[model samples]
Target: MKNILVTGAAGFIGSNLVLELFKEGPYHIIGIDNMNDYYDVSIKEWRLEEIEKNIKKNKWTFIKGNIADKTLIEKIFEEYKPSIVVNLAAQAGVRYSITNPDAYIESNIIGFNNILEACRHSYDDGNNGVEHLIYASSSSVYGSNKKVPYSTDDKVDNPISLYAATKKSNELMAHAYSKLYNIPSTGLRFFTVYGPAGRPDMAYFGFTNKLIKGETIEIFNYGNCKRDFTYIDDIVDGIIRVIKKAPEKKIGGDGLPIPPYALYNIGNSKPENLLDFVSILQEELIRAEVLPSDYDFEAHKKLVPMQAGDVPITYADTSALERDFGFKPSTDLRTGLRKFAEWYKEFYIDGKR
Candidate 1:
């Protein structure tokens, strides 16, 4: 059985991906996460528990550690010798980066470098190691570009936020390592991912929490922002498809490797207005009986100017993804939010009762 290593395995995307992978077949899966208090440790723990329940003994292993720890990462690589390394671990937040830039550097930069170095060393002793390395990148790297439906072919040199800069750095570093070591790698530029058990810091999850407490939820950019909100399942599906196929390593005219690197923008092509998104979410919440039928959503909403590090819109031109993978995110907002609202009720409301 080929070993697969997934970092940040307790996170929203990480956890979901792990769970879905188990369904694919019997393969040894190793997951590691720091379980930090960035949002709520309880949610991470809950995700871990869910993964544990479906895990077959000896087929799965979980480790509690930070990817920023160089020694720890090297130790894992040496011990597991993973055939596929999916580095999903990173400090994820836009506004949080403003307050804590150190976290971004520590995890996004240093930690990723550690992973790359490990992959580079995997073939030191003529070993067929690390067939593919897939890591998470963000659409935030696009910054406040005037382009609609952001494409991978566009030049992304200017980054508005430190968080975006770090993500862009990850891509550059990965490209260099891929060229130098001929390591097959693919970077996924994910747009706004949302679903049940997602991060509490996300707009949908945060709005739900505040509405339950009768607190006003702030709508940024006066609800003028548009986001390509990709559902968790769709994102996971795209990843699984990519995992089965590694970027082909080829020889250049100069007798050198052609990097064997690839990047793709994975998201729902349709972008939804923030106001429209909120309305659908509220409708789903009420439909799920999480809120009352007569709830005053208007009174509980406060439209505000754009915050720093936030983009006005994020639309994905997923033509490349469809052309390559024959798949694009198709989950509509109502369907996705419905699942989230029901899960929220069961997790927070019904469980507490």
Candidate 2:
């Protein structure tokens, strides 16, 4: 069984991926996360618990550290010698990046450079190093494109936010590393991912929390937005399929190994209107008993102008993902929200496992 290293393992996508892999594993899964209080550290802690419940104690290793620490990352590579490296550790949140640009640089830029360096060195002295490197990019790199369905072929030279810029930079950095070291790498540009046990800072979760507290939920862009809200399960499914399939390696005419690099958008091709999404989330919230049946959802919803660094729509052209992986994220918004509502009720209201 291959030893796999997954950074940001306590994170939403990372934890879910780890849990799913553990279910079918004899592999040693090494997970690393700083456990920073980006939102509520408790949610991350709870995710760790969820991961623990699914794995044999000996099969999983959870390390508490930051990827920006080069020495520590090198030590992890040396000790574990992970064959597959998935770098998901990043200072996420577009708006937050405006205020905390340093965080983005530290985690997304410096941290990712370290991962690339580690992967490059893993094959030192003819040692069998990393077989494949998978990392997370974001749809924000599209940067409010007028295009209907965002395509990988679309030029992403314009990014509206620091967060988007950093993600774009990651792709460029990965490509350079791949070219220089022939590291087989795949970068996934994830759409708006939502579901149970998701980040509390995300819209769906925040809206639920606000309604529970009788606070107004802001609907940016005056409810004129559309988003391809891919569910957690769907996202994880795509990652699993991509993880096992590395891009084919090739050699140049000069006998130099060409970088095996690829990029794909992991998203539901279906884009749902913002207001319609809120309605479904509200319905699910009531159905799950997180809100009273008589709750005034309209009163609690505040439609406002779009915020800075916000986009009007995000529609993914997942044709590439489908053609390559034979998989597409098809979970409907209502169905996905229902699951999130149920899980929210269980974890937050009922405190049931």
Candidate 3:
């Protein structure tokens, strides 16, 4: 059985990917996470429990650790000798980067460099090493770009947020490593991903929490922003398809490797207005009985000016993804929100069993 190493295993995307991988085959999966209190430690623990509950026992292993520790990461890579490494364990959240820039630097920069270093050394002495490295790149990398349908070909030099800057740095670093080491790498720039058991810091989850408590929810930029909100299942599906293939390794005209590196945008391709997204979310919450049907959503919403490190819009050009992978994120907003609302009612409202 092939060994797959997933960093940030307890995170929203990390946990989901782990569960889905078990369904794929008898592959042995190794997962590691720091289990930080960035949002809620309980939620991360719950995700781990869910993975254990769903997957076949003995096929998977979970290690509680941080990837920023170079020694720890090197140890994991040496022991597992993973054929595929999925690095999703970065410090998330654009706003959080403003106050806590250190976290981003430590995890997003240092941690990723450690992973790349491990991958580079994996091929030492003619031993077969990590065949492909898939890491999470965020839509935030396209910060402040006025271009609609942000393409992989677009230049993303101006990052409005430190979080975005870190992600862009990841892409560049990966490309450099790929060229030098001939490591097949793919970076996925995910759009606004939302679903059940997602990050509480995300807009949808935060809005749900605030609405349930009868607190006002702020709509940034007066709800004028548009986001290509891709659902979690769709994101997982896109990732699964990506895992089966690696970029072709080839020598360039200069007799050097052309860099076996690739990047793709995973998004719904349908950018939804922020105001409309909230409306649908409210309806879903009421439908799921998380909120009363008579709940005054309008009274609970407050439009606010744009905050620091925030972009007015994020649109993705997924044509390259469709062309290569023959798939794209297609989960509609209502269906995804409904699932989240139902989950919230069960996990938070009823009882977190």
Candidate 4:
């Protein structure tokens, strides 16, 4: 059985990915999360509870800790001896980085350095060392680029936010470690990921919450923004595929490189306008019976100027993902929103009608 360690296991994407891994068979999983109150601690706790309920065997282990602690991280790698390590624990939100820039530096930069160091030394155990190190990057790295349908080949030199800078730093750090220690690492630049149990800070979830409370939903950029929203299941599938296929060492005429590294964009490849997305979401909410059939969505939506650290549009060119994995996120906006609405109604609404 392959031993895998997943950081930020209580997070939306991380928790969903962990559950999927559990269903795949007998594999040792070391799930860790600090359970920070970035959005809501209850949500993280709830995700953990769901995972606990599904654990028929002792394959899943949960540890409440921060990824920034080098000692704790090193201990996990030493004890668990995970052959596959997935680092998804980072200060998430672009706007949050503005007021809390230090958090980004601590978690995304220093914390990731600790992870790289641990992975580097993990080879001390002759037989039990990480074969692949896959970490989460973000499409935010392409901040405000003039190009449409962002590609991995695009020069991502300009980042508009601290969050994007930290993510880009992670990729660079991973590259350095890969070259120095020969760690086979892959960085996935994820697009706007949304689904059931999504982050409350996200527009989709926030809009739903505000609409339910009869509060005006803030539509940033006067509702002109567009995003390539990728579903949670599709993101997990891409991660799993990349995990199984470690990057190969690029051999040149000079000599074999020290390490192997690769980066790919995982997205739906289709961008949808914010208004269209909200309309679909409103429809789904009504269809799921979470909202009343006569709910006035137009009255609830309030168009506003663009907020700081936000991009106007994000479209992903997933050719690399498709070419390598033969997979892409095909779930339409309505389908994904439907699942989210259904789950929200069952979990949070409590049949409130």
Candidate 5:
């Protein structure tokens, strides 16, 4: 069985990916996270509980700690000797980064550096160690670009938020390490990932919470913003495909670096308007009994100007993802949101109480 170390395994995407990985076969998993109260520790803990319930034999090990802890990360690498490492643990949220810039610097930047260093030194035993290193990048990197579908080849030099800056920095760091140490790494620029057990700070979940509480929900950019909302299952599938196939070395004439390293945008090609997305979500919530059937969504939604570090739109050009993996996120908004509503009712409404 392959040994895989997945950081942020208790997170929405990470937890879902762990469940999927377990289904593939018996594989030893070293899951690490700080379990910070950034959102709700109970939600993260509940996800772990669900994983444990399924894999009763304990094919997974959980380590509660921060990724920025260099000694801890290095020790885990030395002991587990993980062949594949997926770094998804980072200080998430674009708006939060504005007030808590220190968090981003410490977790995203410093923590990422630690992960790279550990991966580099893992080969000290004179073995072909760490065949692949996959980490999370965000669509926020293409901040305020006038382009319709943001392509991976587009110049992403301008980042409007600290979160975007940190993500872009991760790409640059990975490139330098890949060039210097010949460690095959891939960075996935996920586009607005959402679905069952999604982050509460995200628009969909936040809006749902306010709508249920009979509170006015703020609609940024006067509800004109668009987003390429990708589903969790699709993101996990794309990760799995890319993990198995690392990038090929580009020769001198190609204008690309030598060695196996690549970056791809995993997203739904279709960009939906913010207003339409909320409407669909409202419908799903009402259908799932999370909200009253007669709930007045129009009265509860308040249109407002864009907030600081907010982008107008985000659309992904998944041509590279399709050309290479022959797969793309195809789940429609209604379908994905329906699953999310069901999960919210079961977990928060029924199970938690």
Candidate 6:
């Protein structure tokens, strides 16, 4: 059985990916997460509990530690010797990075460097180690582009937020490592991932909470934004397909290793208008009994100007992903939001199981 190491395993995407990986594998998984209270620590613990319930204790190993800890990360590499490493442990949230920039530097930048160093050393002494290194990138990397459907080929030099800058830095770091040590790396630029048990800091979940509490919810950009909302299941499916395939490690005539690195946009190709998305969310909330049908939806919403670190629109061009993997995220906004609503009712209202 191949050993797989997944960092940030308690996170929304990480936990979902872990559960999906469990469905078809004789593989052993080593999951590590710092469990920082960026949003709510209880939710992270709840995700871990769910993972514990599904897989056998022996088949999976859980490590509650920070990836920025170089000694600890190196020890994990030595002990586990994972053939596949998926780095998802990064400080999330574009807005949070504005106020708490140090957190992003320590976690996203330092933590990623530790992962790269560990992967570099894993190949010591002719060891067939770390066949694939997959890390998470963000749609925020495409900052304030006038173009619709952002592609991987588009130049992403201009980043509006520190979070976007760090994500772009990760791609450059991976490229350097790939060229130096022949590491096969694939970076996935996710576009507005939302689903059941998602990040509470996100708009959909926060909007649900605010609407239920009888509070006014601020709609940024005067509800004139657009987002390519991708479902959690579709994200997991893309990650799984990417994990099985590694980039072709080739060499050039000048004795330099042609970096076996690739990047893809994993997102629902359709970008929905912000106003239309809120409408669908409101309908789902009422359908799931999280909000009353007669609730004054018009009064609770307050449209405001765009925030400092947020973009007006995010549209993904997944043509390259489709051509390479023969897959595309097809989950509609309403269906995905419906599932999130049902999950919210089950988790927050019905005693949370």
* Candidate 4 per-residue lDDT over residues 39-141, each given as its tens digit: 9787888889889888765499889898899999988988888999999999999999999899999899999999999999987757556899999999999
Estimated TM-score per prediction?
A: 0.98, 0.98, 0.98, 0.96, 0.96, 0.98
Task: List, residue by residue over 28-116, the lDDT tens digit for candidate 6.
Answer: 99999999999888889888989888885337899999999999999999999999999999999999999999999998899999999
Q: In candidate 5, residue 78 scores what lDDT? A: 87
Q: What is the lDDT of residue 90 in candidate 6?
A: 96
Lowest summed lDDT window (length 10), candidate 1: 52-61
| Backbone collisions counted per model | 0, 0, 0, 0, 0, 0
Error of 2 at 7 (Å): 0.3
- Tell how far residue 210 is off in model 3, in angstroms: 0.8
Number of colliding residue pairs in model 4: 0
The parts of candidate 5 lying over 4 Å away from their true place are: 56-58, 249-257
Overall lDDT per candidate, in order of appearance: 0.94, 0.94, 0.93, 0.90, 0.90, 0.94
Candidate 3, 91: how far from true, in Å? Answer: 0.3
Instruction: Output the worst ten-in-a-row residue range by lDDT, candidate 3.
Output: 54-63
Worst 10 residues of 4 by lDDT: 250-259
lDDT of 6: 0.94
Q: Which 10-residue window in model 2 sums to the lowest lDDT?
A: 50-59
Per-residue alpha-carbon lDDT of model 5 for 1-353, expressed as tens digits?
77899999999888988888887757888999899999978889888987887774437989999999999999999889999999999999999998889999999999999999999998886977898999999999998889879998988999999999999999999999998777899999999999988899999999988887899999999999998899999999999888789776555566655867899999998889999999899999999999989998889989999998888889999999999998767788899999999999998788864
